[model samples]
Target chain A: IDAVCTAHGLSVAEFHALRARATEAKTRAYCPYSNFRVGAALLARAGEGEGESGGRYVLGANVENASYPVTTCAERVALGTAVVEGLHSGNGRGFRAIAVSTDAEGPASPCGMCRQFIREFCELSMPILMFDKNDTFIVMTLGELLPLSFGPDNMGVKDPAKP
Target chain B: IDAVCTAHGLSVAEFHALRARATEAKTRAYCPYSNFRVGAALLARAGEGEGESGGRYVLGANVENASYPVTTCAERVALGTAVVEGLHSGNGRGFRAIAVSTDAEGPASPCGMCRQFIREFCELSMPILMFDKNDTFIVMTLGELLPLSFGPDNMGVKDPAKP
Candidate 1:
């Protein structure tokens, strides 16, 4: 935990908080259809003028619709809420790490859509922490999860993730 | 508005509000990638003990991700929020109508994924209202949008829409 946190610029508190809260968020999921529950917690990067030590956290659980495609995954709900709440991405300000918790035996990764969504506001180097129900976990950077990602730069639009 | 509202059991006020709100919701969309903005509103089934005439309205706009597939349609966002806020789908108590507004020349219907999500909560007869940028519109039932639907009943689960 110490080495991982240090390497990712996350504090021990942030790491633990993400895991615990993501687990807790799963209980709030309204998944009567697939009966699958997922929870996500996002750690924001520190704002300008502040050292890159402390940041805020946002949480979301999978919100499924009977229409499977309409379901918003845990990572997305967190990202949407963050965007609406004014967590801008650009100029080195954006999310630091994302922690996701699920009830599977193996660590559950973000789906394709979520990988795309995260690409909008997170850096290629942002760490994604996936935790299985047993607390066993694996981590990957955003670049590895979604290779050759398309973004604002692709469309010639100025975007935070580009820089 | 009056004719369609009467046919769908929606009052003129309700129908107009749905259109206006859905259109308004489109402005709040975070679609820097696709440059396409969409909005949706859902009318809840009336409360138990009350006739199936009036229910509350929930709104959501398309929240886009840099990844196109992860881009959530406006329809799903509304449904997810409804579920989180304690709306139940059964016993004539799910959504009665869904309205979508987009800035296209023709009416923009909910995507296939959204159709499936609606299936989880809506009755077959539920009407879907589509509005173009000019508010010129079309309407279809959930059944028509997605025929031969699959539901919780397929998995041997007792669900309201299934019965």
Candidate 2:
């Protein structure tokens, strides 16, 4: 936990809160198809005086459709909610970190589609925290997870919140 | 148009409206990445006393992410919105038909992921209407679009709305 806190600049409290909130969000998932519930929480970059845990956080749970392909993973749902709320366009940098919790025995990482989605709003160095049911976890930077990634910069598209 | 109307049990006006609405929704897309715009409209089944066009219609425009795979196709976006609106849990059938419009030369088909997503909420015979830039179109049933598809049934799962 100390290593994670140090590596990501998150206080121990912030890390614990992220885990609790992400686990809570997992319960709200609509996944009759997969019976696999995944929850995600994002820590948005905060303003000047806000302390480590003071940043705005948004939660998202997997919303599955009967058609499996239609399933919106926990990661994309969180990011989509962020975009709709105008968080992506905010100052102080876009996203600081994202954490995901799932009921799987082993840590489950973001899928290809979600990795792409993260590439949109997060810097390559942004950390993604994955937690399994047992609280065992693994962490990977966005850059390490998706090498040679394509981003909005590729198309000369700046921030999504900008016109 | 006449054949589509006759074959699909839709009146001429319904067909025209689906095409027009889908085309209009295309204008709302946020695709700075691919510059590939797609719009989709679903004709939900109305309750007994509803008018021909009275069934609620849901519109979706492709919302892109910097990561290409994270980019949701227009079809899934519309369907996801429907799920969030409590429309999927309605007494009437979830959706009767889906129409997609794009600026591509020939009609654009829904992607493989979208085809899988469509399989969940629609019946095998559900028709998918594809419209190109010139207002030209082609119609195919969901079963035809995705052959031997996998769905909730495959996983012993059921209604997306049901807990």
lDDT per residue (tens digit) for residues A30-125 in model 1:
677788899888888767777756467877888765445556788877776566444655345678899999999999999887888888878898
The runs of at least 3 residues in candidate 1 whose Cα sits more than 4 Å from the true structure, single-residue gaps closed, are A11-13, A28-35, A43-59, A63-72, A80-93, A147-150, A155-157, B44-57, B64-67, B84-93, B160-163
Model 1 score (lDDT)? 0.79
TM-score of 1: 0.75
Write out the backbone clash pairs for model 1. Answer: A66-B120, A67-B116, A67-B117, A90-A160, A116-B67
* Native-to-model Cα distance after best TM-score fit, residue B83 in candidate 2, in Å: 1.6
Candidate 2 residues B1-163, lDDT tens each? 8987888877787788789889987876778878898988887877556665558777877878765556787787677555544455555646778899999999999988888877776777878999999998999998899998777777777744232
Candidate that would win on lDDT: 1
Q: What root-mean-square deviation over C-alphas does model 2 reach?
A: 6.3
TM per candidate comes to: 0.75, 0.64
